[model samples]
Target: MAHPSSSHSRLFRASLLALPLLLGGAAWAQQPPPAASAAAPAADPGRHMLAEIQVIPRPVGTADDRYKHVDAAIAVIQASGLRYEVHGLGTVVEGPPEKIWPLLQAVHEATLQAGAERTLSIIKVSGGAQAGGPRVEDLVRKFRN
Candidate 1:
């Protein structure tokens, strides 16, 4: 025998509590449809794309005192035929994405083949709207002197 006004207030409070969950569910469900394949690139590549890559390999318990695995990766980069510059931290290569992606993979594999048990690579890509970004030479021009 609850009062009619009291029952209406209880229902209103319950709905207020449920509103957020309902809205959140709707927002989550509104996400764009999935792409046809997982391997698809996120965006279309422009004519010029640049990638800066650094490969570091840990060659467990070696006293050679030289980074042979890193050297192996460098050799792969050199042979990639893409425009590249070797810096103290990483190497920057400018070219089309189609070429740069495989080149990065090859560098990682080459380091492993050179006897590294574990390898870590850092990569940064700039293209599309940033296609006109500075090249490697531009960054190192003042230092070249």
Candidate 2:
């Protein structure tokens, strides 16, 4: 029987390592090409209440500084005749879509006025028939204290 040399042993080990990579690359070869613009946003015309929020000047600095800014912003928003709750560093204010939109705009303007340098993200929540978009109807279902 002939024995393999050191060079042949090295080559054999290298080929073993390369086999899995080659097989994985071949698996991707059969997939179809992607579309030009990818998937489009489907229009949900289900009368959903969508909240348009502007989260300007989010907490970017230290935790204490961020808390200060958040608290101040929350105060201003709270004074605007709305019910709000601050969960951790985020604020959750519930109301009609129309009311929430204006509140978000106010929050953005106030945050800028309070000397916020960081950019804020705007978010929206659309609760369908499940929650009815934070209407005044929730008050009627309140639990007896």
Candidate 3:
């Protein structure tokens, strides 16, 4: 019988050898996007991306306003002029990558500034490189009743 540690080492070596095969898609991603034809209309920057943001604030402080800290963060999103919808878990905001990326940082920082002892913001952003990703409605329309 081979030693368990030796067997595991051999398995690890095998996995390492397979890394390039597993990461072949990553190499494709690094390649430049195909050039757009002159006749194609450019995608609007304001409608190119969607971001889901969830902020959790600690030491909520009171029963009457348990979401006080969270609400403060939300206020920033509401005023940003970007299209957004607040769901049970998070708020989804839509716009360009340039705006959405920095705005995510603002939302996370807003909770801490709202007197939260600690805070966390989970964000998911979706977009494409050259063409542009789907709209919020395009993604969830079929699922809706």
Candidate 4:
């Protein structure tokens, strides 16, 4: 298997660093999501967005591996090009809610594709209708080292 180059790693790190600005800037708010120029803002008027999304895949444990299903669900999140950070209880994602919300469904379905009989998703979203909301850095920058 081919390994990811250092440039790809740097690119991904840059994406993470840039995510907060994207999620909390008037520039992003004024424009529509990449794919949905006209329909997205109408569907979700929030100027910026952040979501804590967690997926639980049932048959959550097996004799062979306790976290197999959970791993599959996480794989989907990692593969998504959107910027995200995985935390203890959930993974936080930042982007236009119109795009993030739809992607949540895909994350939820990933475990089922991995052979889980059932799945559940817990999601919490925060944003503003009149202006951009706080970015992750804005909320927890002090906690970082």
Instruction: State which candidate has the highest TM-score.
Output: 3
Instruction: Please give the TM-score that candidate 3 achieves against the real structure.
Output: 0.65
Error of 1 at 31 (Å): 15
Off by over 4 Å in 4: 1-46, 61-64
Which ranges in model 2 have alpha carbons more than 4 Å from their true place? 1-66, 127-131, 134-145
lDDT of 3 by residue, 1-145 (tens): 9999999999999988777668785576468888877784544654588899999879653477888888888889998888999998999999887778878988888888878889878889888776567889988999999
lDDT of each: 0.81, 0.59, 0.83, 0.80
Please rank every candidate by TM-score, starting with the best.
Answer: 3, 4, 1, 2
Q: Cα-based RMSD of the predictions, in order?
A: 12.5, 13.0, 8.3, 18.8
- Ten-residue stretch with the least lDDT total in model 1: 38-47
Per-model TM-score versus the true fold:
0.61, 0.44, 0.65, 0.63
Give the alpha carbon lDDT tens digit for every residue of 1-145 in model 4: 4467977998999998788678987576567656745543465445678989887778875768887777777787788777788888788988777778887888888878878899889999987765578888888899999
Q: What tens digits encode model 1's per-residue C-alpha lDDT throughout 50-130?
A: 788888888722577477888888889899888998888888898877788899899888889989999999999876664
* Deviation of model 4 at 45, angstroms: 11
User: Among all windows of ten consecutive residues in candidate 3, which has the lowest summed lDDT?
Assistant: 38-47
Best by lDDT: 3
- Write down the lDDT that model 1 would get: 0.81
Give a tens-digit lDDT track for model 2, residues 34-129: 777666454444333534354546554345475554455677778866666554546666655456666777776666566666657566665665
